[model samples]
Target: MSISSSGFSWPLRVYYEDTDVSGVVYHANYLKFFERARTEWLRSLGYSQESLRHEVEVAFTVSRVEVAFRSPARLDDQLIATVAVTELKRASLVMTQQLRLGDIDGRLLAEAEVKVVSVDAASFKPCALPDGFRNRVQTVENAASRNPSSSAA
Candidate 1:
């Protein structure tokens, strides 16, 4: 529910369905949380996935993900999911995302480095990111990098 030069932070509450039998968040749900955060980040910049596909004829697909689980997030836990673009290329981008307990600087439950590729929505073939989107991302990334206090952890 906050934004900094570091990234966009989205607050979420753990639901029973997001947990395993032991009440800990299921491993796969972390991916979902990351995805949602990324989506919201794009939305914050005025681009929705749907519009990107239909208007720009581009779609972003996850090409790789490397996650490190530091601690467990249990049911009813208030969490904050963060999305920060680390690297941006013509056809792809890399992001560092984290699930933290309570706040942006709270306990890190899990962190992921994700790479996403832009592709032709209809053919699903690799393609360069649309110019407008790319430009906007560059603006955000540049601003974040300039703000020393908002450096990623």
Candidate 2:
């Protein structure tokens, strides 16, 4: 299994469409926000699910998602979504994710534990991660080792 990364963060801003009638972000909208962060995290590594499918004929799918609501995020609030690997198998990965409020001292907003499985595009069956994919993700681990917080400190 791959070890935990110190953590990766993606900045976001809560928009009007993301909220409910009460002005707080709907519970489920966080999932979309989280997904975007993860996807961007992968993009930062120079890979994308779409490219992974078109170029490598493989894609990642959410096998399971477990969310824990810790706090509310309101419209216009800047937030940060985090992604960190907790475990990795040949064909699946477990990630510990969190959403934190920005501008107010990095407060915890919500958290989730998500598991993803890689599958072949043609057959939609589980598949081992291609060498490139594994290597790219491993880059995150190495960077975390060098700078866990993604800061020069």
Highest lDDT against the true fold, candidate:
1
lDDT of 2 by residue, 25-66 (tens): 999999998998889878877888889999999989999999
lDDT on C-alpha atoms for all candidate structures: 0.86, 0.86
Model 1, 1-153: lDDT tens digits are 112347778888899999999999999999998998899889877899999999989999999999999999999999989888888888998988999998555999999999999999999999998888988887876777678555332
Which residue pairs in model 1 clash with each other?
none
Best by TM-score: 2
lDDT for 52 in candidate 2 is: 92
> What's the number of clashes in each of the models?
0, 0
Off by over 4 Å in 1: 1-5, 103-105, 148-153
Q: Which stretches of candidate 2 lie over 4 Å from their true place?
A: 151-153
